[model samples]
Each structure stands twice: as structure tokens, then as C-alpha cells.
Target: MSSSNHGLARKLGGWQLWGIAVGLVISGEYFGWSYGWAQAGTLGFLLSSIFVAIMYTAFIFSFTELTTAIPHAGGPFAYARRAFGPVGGFIAGFATLCEFVFAPPAIALAIGAYLNVQFPELSAKWIACGAYIVFMALNIVGVSVAAAFELVVTLLAIFELLLFMGVVSPGFSWDNFTHHGWAGSDSFSLSAVGGMFAAIPFAIWFFLAIEGAAMAAEEAKDPSRTIPRAYVAGILTLVALAMGVMIMAGGAGDWSKLANINDPLPQAMKLIVGSNSGWLHMLVWLGLLGLIASFHGIIMGYSRQIFALARAGYLPPMLAVIHPRFKTPHRAIIVGGMIGIAAIFSDDLIQIAGQPLTANIVTLSVFGAIVMYIVSMLALFQLRRSEPALARPFSAPAYPLLPGLALACAVICLIAMIWYNQLLALIFAGSLAVAYAYYLLTHRQRAAAASDVLLEGNDAARLKPAVARSK
Candidate 1:
């Protein structure tokens, strides 16, 4: 099929990109909320909020340079393919798939937690299954459907947060904050930084997926301009929201109380707003809707990245195919949905097995992403020093220094993950090592094939403007 006829539509705008960022980050409950509160007390919350903000800034700056130059649909895979080669791109893309693959069950579990609050009798697995169905439907329809759904969910989440923030702020006790002060009885010293690093996965996970926002670069109008603005703005907004939520929630009650409560916001709301006003149902529904919207946003991103990887020859070609009628990557969408469904069931089995499900899975994702980020920042530096002539509308401030700090933090966080969650750390590194071995064996053939396609892509990209001008 001709490219245009394939229905691989590309039409998204700045606001929609913002929606993507909001949706991805706001889905904090799925991974961060539960894990973060448990792992880090007040200090962990503060350090993670700051660390993620800085790390995201670094990632955004590095990614903005690439998106401005390439402005393609494939996101990191495309960048890696162009900069490192087909094998590098494949690794980048596959790592992303792993993150998302693990994330679906994590989100399902989070949704299950929220649902359990309302309908105590319903199994969490069932709620996760229901959430998956709703998001899958949103994704299958089209990008526009996904975008619209995300915008609604993003707004509702923000509103729910606003309500929580408003309610908790007034009721916050300073004594609640400073009283016990810092978990495990540690004074302000170098030791505290160690705690921050250990808590980094759960804390930083909240801000991790802002990079997914760039997945919509091809769809965005004026990507070179829209991408950087949307990307930076999204990260900033998420950091602000996270800070507000953690501070308010922590202050409204003893930070220690959060460890006991499954749903901290509802409990904090109960403490501040009280239950008799009949607003409890609204809060519950609002929170539930936020989780659903967040899941919808996640599925959209994961599927798009899968489609991108397939298109770039990182996966089987069948996954790259667009629907002849719908112009959507229907195959990839279904695959992602299936993974999510499987996640729900697997989580249920874990409960039945009574095995200790270490929060290590969460740690694995954070470590893997940080490793990717480190590689990406290195790519950015290489590009700047090696390809100074490359057109860049946006550049990271302070040249090497600011981005240097960001890279340092990412590396430090990776080391901390190893220190705290060695098993997960080993698994993450080992998984990549396996992918590298596979690449080493088949890389030559893959490179030849990818090169031919990339050349065709370049020719097509050059011809596109002329073709439009002629018309």
C-alpha cells in the first residue's frame, strides 16, 4: 500500500501532546503512589520530587534536540536508529516495551486498589480487567479518541488533586510534618542521600514517563516548536502536582499513618473533608475516573512505541501494519491490550501463590529507564560535540554542566537501585545483556535491512515537501 493510503494518519497538536504528558505522569497511583509512600517517608518524597524534576529536565532537553531534528513517530527507537544504528534502536525500543509490559499489571493493581475502596467485595483482578477493557477500546478507536479521552481524564485527575490539596492544606498540622521527622531516625547527613537514592524508583517513577509525551512528535503540529514547550511544561506541571500532593497528604496526617492506609488520599480526605457530607462518593468516583484515564493514556503510549519499533525494524513487521480503513496500528494496539489482560491474571495468581512479590519489579523499571536516560544524554553530548552543525532550535542551558548534573543524578540513582534492590538491578542489566548478545549475533543482517529502509525514509522525507509544494 502507498504510505498515504495506508491510513497512518499524523495529526496531533501542542495541547494534545500536553495531554499525553499529563496522562502519563498523573497515573502516579499505578506505580508511584503506592510504592513511593511505602518506600520513602517525608524526606524520600521531597528528594524524589526534586530528583525527578531535575532528571526529567535533562531527558527533555536531550530528547528535544532529537525530536527537533527528526520529528518522527518512532520516538526513542527512531533516535537510536539514526544515531547508534539498528541494533541500538532495537535495544532502546525493546527496553521501552519491557517497561510498558510490566507497567500494565502495575496500573491494574493500582486501579484495583482504588476500586477496592468503594466495592470492598470485588476482586482487584476484576477491576484491573475492567480498566484494561475500557482503555483498549479507547486506543482501538484512534489517536483522536485517545487524545480526547486523555484530556478528560487529565482534567479530572487535576481536579481530584485540587480537591485533595484544598481540603488537606487547611487541615495540615505543622506538628504532623516535623514531629517524628525523617523515618528510621537518621539525622541530616550524607546518610539521608542514601535513603533518597533507595527510594528513587518509587519516588522518581512518578516523573519517569514524560518522555512518552514525545511519542506524539510526528502527530504534533510544528513539532520542532511544540515538542520542547509541551515536553518541558508537562514535566514542570507534574513536579508541581507531585509536590503538592505529597506535602498536603503528609501534613494532614502523620506520615507514618500513610504506611497503614492503602488509599492515602481518601483517608486524608476523610480526615479533612469528613464523610458525612455525601461528597465521599464524588471523590471516590473522581479518583476512579482518574485511574481509568491514566490507564488509557498509558496504553496509547505503549502501543504507539510498539508500532514505532515495528516500523523501524526492531520487531516483526506485522506489528507495524496500519489498518487499511482506520489508519491506526490496530495489530500493535491489540497486542498491548492482550499484555494488559495477561497482567491482571498474573497479578491474581501472585496473590493466590502467596509469594513475596518484591517491589523489585518497580525498581527494575526505574533502573532500566535511568540506564536508557544515561545513554541518551551521552548521545546528546556526542551529537553536540560531533555534529555541531546539526540544526537545533532548542539547546540545554549551561552547555555541558547542567545536563552533566542530570546525567550524574541518573547514574547515582542507578547505583542506588543496585545497592538497595540488587536482584532487580541485576535482572535489568542482565536482560539488556541478553538483548546485546542477540544483537551481536544477528546485527549485520539487521543493519543492512535497516539502512535500506532508512535511506528510503530519507528520500521520502525529502520528497514530501516538494510533493506538497507542487500541489
Candidate 2:
């Protein structure tokens, strides 16, 4: 249980895992996804959200099979590695790292925006960087404390979203929601079609990192029983919240006004409640819980991913070191925090394809999530055929059907994201290329041995140094 042995302590149960699962994604309801309104208008974005919802529903259900079977902290990386070997592991691990590491900056910015309502003089970016410091420190303190905090904040966030919806219900108008719902025309014309396609990443924001719960598998009290329950409940909760929040917000006032901003709900609510209303101020404060939940949870996610990758020798071994007193991946947590802080500052320096910086960061993170999803589905298929004897406590109900559907949706979304955000896509691709080159030049042999150790259901970092001794 001590980091002296370099292993994670098991301290989570089904409800805590459920909290992490929902907490990781609840911020999508609070903000970020509203950019879809700018891209596709209300109706078009709703359609896009439906498409993305189907994908996540199928994906989380299907993804559970691999998670329970391997139960590794690496999550998709472990699933892909077991099914496709080192090369597969590299792709999934890197993509996952990108997804987790990049997602926090967007949430951090949302946190800053929420705080700005209460204190206008503060620089949002500095508040964002400050948030990264606070939460990363919390994550490094220990997994148990972090998960408990996630559960509490997640509950508060869910309650706040429901409160927003209730307070705005009397102002909801079907005509207001339907008013110019479709982008660019009376019907789904060429421009509307393009907008819907472009909206894919924003819609994806609704359920982006729910799979990150798997990163805590090493710390789950009973992953086999808990992961499935958590994932299933989590997806259902997010879907209902996403649909309800989006519908109510669009009808609350001019949907156009809420579009193109990081803080959507408060703006939408302000239209109904007035900017100076105590209800409006209450919302601004409570909404921060959603952003904080996601920001903090994703920090936990990225650190574990970095820890897992480093453990497998895919990165510097020092990055994998666990804290002896805290038994947390302190080094990995700090490294990911440093990267997120840099990204938060970079928001003011650049614009990609004329979209807002938040939009681009969201797409960049989605690209990584989609890529990881594709590799993971392929891994699931390969594992089914090749590892028939491997213990599977929970089988994906429809087998090829469910996974195939998830794969198809992921591929389509990735294609649309690339077409719409070519500049950011190129940036993401370039970063991956650079990292892969480092992997090839410095870590191949050690990573190969580490791969074997993982496949044997052992902690790879512990055995990684035994490579020479084994030979």
C-alpha cells in the first residue's frame, strides 16, 4: 500500500468510481460544448450531440470489457498493448496522454471565467494557472482524498445544473428554441451540413473523458464490479443532463448570445433572471463546482496515464515514481500540471482557423480521444479473437455490433474534426510525431520488456529494471 513498493493503493468503490466518471464529464454541461451553437445553431448542434451521444453510450458499454479484464492504470494503453503489442500500446498511450493532458486547460479556463463573474478585475488566465496548481497538489496528496472530493463536488455540480434548469423553466419557449435553430438556412443546406460536421468536437465535449475512470482501476477497491456499474450509470447521468441542459438553455433566451462563450449557462440564465439577480450570482458561484470537478478529476487522469507510460519505459522512469508518504504519482502529477499551465497561457497567443482558443483546445483534446477510441475498439476486436481464454467478467453485450458502432462514430467524428480544425489537427499530429521519434531512439528495448511484464499481469515499472538480470 506504500509507494515504497511503487504501487497504487486501492481506496475506491463503485460510487466513488461513478463520481469520478461523472465528475470527469459534468463540466461539459457547465460549459465548453456551447461552442457547438456557434458552429451548427441549436437544432443542428442538437443533432450532432445525438450522434455523439450514441457513440459514447456504445463506447462506454463496450470499453468496460477491456477495462475489467486487464484492470490496469493505463486503461486504453493497457487494452491496446495487450491486444496489439508495443506499437499498439504506444499509439493508445500517447493518444490517451494527449486527451487527458490537454482537456484540463479548457476546464481551467472555464473555472477562470466563472470566477471572473464574481471578481471582474482578476486575469482569467492567472486564475486558470492557479487552479492547476491547487488541484494538482490535491491529486498528489492521495487517491482516496481526491476521489472523495470528486464525489462531493460532482454531486454539488449535478445539483447546480438541475437548479439552473428549474429556475429557467418558466422562461423556456419552444419557439425561442426553434427560432433559427438550423444554421445558415431554412433547411439542412450545404452550409448547414458543414456546420453540423464542424460541431462534432463540441458535441463530443459532452462525454469526452468518462473513460478516464479506468485510469483509476489500479486504485479501485474492486474494479470488476465497480467499473461496469460506474460507467453505465455515468453515461446515463451525463446524457440526461446534456440533453436537458442544452434544451433549457437554448430556450431560456437568444441562443446566439450564449454561443461562442466559455460560460454558457450563466449567460442563458441571466437572460431569464437578469444579470443583477441573486439567482444569477448564485448560479455563477455554484457552477464552479462542475468546472472544479472536471479540472481536478482530469488532473488525476493525466497523472495516472503519465505514470503508466513511464512505468512501461515509454518515458523517463523518474516520471513514474510514486510518493512514499502519499503513495501517489507526484512527479507525473507535477509534470502534467506544468504542461497545462503553459497551455493556459498560450490561449492568448494564438487562434486556429479563426475559432476561439477554447474551441481549438477542445478539438485538439477530442482528436486525441477519438484516436484513442479507434485504437481501443480495434484492440477489443483483436482481443476477442486472440485471447479467447483471457478472463472476462463482463462481456460487451452485442460484441461486434456495439464496438463496431462506436468505432464508426469515432472515425466519422475524427474525419469531421480534421476537416474543420486542420491547423490544430496538424499541431497535434506534429507533437505525436516528435514524441514517437523519442520513443524510437531511446526506449525500445526497455519498453519491450516492460510490455511483457504488463501482459503477465504484473506491475511493469517494478520489473522494468530487471531486464538485464532476466536476460
Candidate 3:
């Protein structure tokens, strides 16, 4: 295939897609962050993890259907436009942008926190800034670099998880399974459900870039065959990793010890490997490298989203521009990097995006992305019903049923997040509304101008005389 035949670049294959998914899955280290809720009590953590897993499962299927149908350069944005029109596309794309914009800093912040444990002398901000610079350079160079980076990072992540599980041979207290102690406090009951709800957004956030694999659909060697297969494999890989980490780490340590450490993986390692082993130090750094890879995945995902939006006329057209030499979404990559840099200065740096001021900001992004998923799923049902004859290379299993479950779970998760953080939900919804309003006004003005030209009759297609007008 000619290089020009594909938008941006046609460099990604099934392995690249798989590596991106695996890299993203292992990046956030849920067990590392969610250990707080576990320390609060086992049930709280278990319930929250299950809730997130279910929601995430649905999201994967939902993405699979849409990505399979319209494997375009823009991913969700293009699907929304084709299914719901330009305004719908704008909202979905913007929500995704909201998700992506928040993500880079969150990962950077987490990486900085981990660095603090190892290098207390250096500033977290400097380390984070440096990490962003490295990842940005990798992305601008091309997907090949991004894929290679993801491959190494993901492998390290796996090694770290396995090594930790191995070192903590006997595991921790079985009491952790039934212990009802709530994290942050000791109230465990229906009230803990509120705590679980409070935890939902970030729980969902852990899986933020899973859909990013879809962004590479246009570049995949065989999108129709590759997309669905990749989606299934990616989701399975994430679930296994998350569950394995939670179970293995949860089994090996005192829940409260996990609660104390800001970055859980290092703490877990300290417990399993102890301070004496030089080999343990190498393993710990492996986890850090995984964090770095996760950052790269987020950058790649959101940059493509920005590129998609620009291509669809939702943002400045420059955002959609591709680098002639690198064959990547160069403009969007730069823009996303700038957004990450600015996020470092925001006041709500630690505050989560949703309610009680405890809402996880990264989780808020996940909530918004779920909203996009719902939109895309609905689009799938509508497209199927309205255009039944349209050629579909690969339809999801059980047609409407599988997709329906995914949509239903998405709505439930959205409601859960809204209950936990009405303000964040309102912020997301309000921002999208403003964007949609702008789209409508611009579209209407353009239409009116076109109509005026039509009403001008022969003047619309007039042949000008050689003479000048009065002006």
C-alpha cells in the first residue's frame, strides 16, 4: 500500500495495537493507587474493583462495534459525526479531549510521586516535565518509536508484577478478604457504597486509554480483522493484569501499609523484596519504567484524538495536520504536550474532577470517556437499524444484546459518578453544551449565507463582465 493511502501513518500493526493496550493497562497500576480503598476495608476495595471491571468490559465491546464499522482516522470523533452528525461529533470528541488532557498530568504526577521515594533531593515537577519531554519526542518521531517504547515498558510492567507476586510467596493476611474496615476511616456499611461510588471515577480512570487502540485502526494492517481481535485481547489482558495485581499484592502485604504508601507498587516491593537485595532495586525500577510507558500511551491516544477532531472541523484545522516526513499527527502531538505542561500549574492538581472535593480528576476523565462510549454504541444501534444494508465487515457478537449491555453498564457507571461528584459531571456536561452551542451557531450562519446566495438566483453563478462595479 502507498504511504499516502492512509491518513497520518499506516505503520501500526496488531502487535503495535496490542502493545499500546497492554502498556496503557499496566501504566496506572490500580493496585498501587487503589490500595487506599482496600485498607479502608476489603469489601470496599473488592466492590469498587468489580464495579470498574464490569463497566470497563462494556466499554471494550462498545468500542469494538464502532471501531469495526468505521475504522477511520478520527476514531470516536468520526463515528459520532457519521452517526449523530457534526454536533454530536463535537461533544464526543471534546469529552475525549477532556479525558486525554487530564490524563497526561495525572500519569506524570504519579511518576513524580514514585521518583520522590527514590530521589528525594529532586523536585517532582522537574522530573515530570522531563518525562513529558522524552515521551513527546518519542511520539513525534512516529508510531514505530511509540510501539517499541510500549513493548519494553509493558514487558517491564509484567516482570515487575510477576516478580512481586513471586517474592511475596505466602502472601498477606486472609483477613483482608473479609475485613470491613473502611479506608480513610472505619465506617463500613451502605455508607461504604458511597465510598465505593466516590472511588468509581478513578477506578474507571485506570482503564482510560483502552479505547486508544481504536485510534490506530486506520493504521492497522487489516483493520476489519485486526480491530475486533485487538479489542478482545486488550480487554482480557487488562482484566487479568488488574485482578492479578490486586489479588497478589493484596495477599502479600498489610493493607494498612499499602494505604500509607502514596505509590503502592514500591511499597509492595519493599514488603516483598525488603531492603537487602540489589536484585530487588532493579525490579522496582522496572515498575517505574512501566509508568513512563503509560505516559507515552496517553500522549499517543489523545494526540490522535486531537488530530481527529481537527480533521472533522471541530477544532482549529492545524490540529489535524500530519507531519510530511514523520507521517504522524505532529500538530496534535505538540498541542497535547502543551496541555500536559500547563496542567502541572493548575490548582486542582490533586483534587479529583468529581464531588465532595475527593473526586479523582483522572477518574472524571474516565467518566467523560464512558459518555463518549455510550454515544458511539447508540450510534452503532442507530446505524444498524437505519442502514441495515451497509456493508459490515465484522459485527459484534449477539448484535444489539452485547452492545446493549455495554451501553447499559456505561449509563449506570455515569450515574454512579454523577452521584459521587455532581459538580464534575456538571462541568463536563456544561463544557460539552457550550461547544455544541458554538457548533450550532456557526453551522446556522454558514447555512444562512448559503441560502442567501441561492436566493440571489443567476447572481450565484454569474459571469462577470469586463467592466468594474460602482465600488
Question: Highest TM-score, which number?
Answer: 2
**Candidate 2 off by > 4 Å:** 1-3, 444-453, 456-466, 469-471
Report the alpha-carbon TM-score of model 3 versus the true structure.
0.86
- lDDT (0-100) at residue 251 of candidate 3? 58
Task: Write the residue-wise lDDT of candidate 1 on 45-128 in tens digits.
Answer: 577667777777776766677777766666667666656755667667766766666666666666787778788999887888
Count clashing residue pairs per candidate: 2, 0, 11
lDDT of the candidates, in the order given: 0.68, 0.89, 0.68
Decoy 2 TM-score against native: 0.96
Model 1: clashing residue pairs?
7-327, 12-219
Give stretches of model 3 more than 4 Å off.
Answer: 1-6, 30-40, 181-188, 260-262, 347-359, 437-471
lDDT of 2 by residue, 60-178 (tens): 99999988998888899989887887778899999999899989999999999999989999989999999998998899888999999999999999999999999999999988887
Tens digit per residue, CA lDDT, model 3, 140-247: 898888887787778778777777667765655556534444544546666676777666665665566788777777777788777777778878877777766766
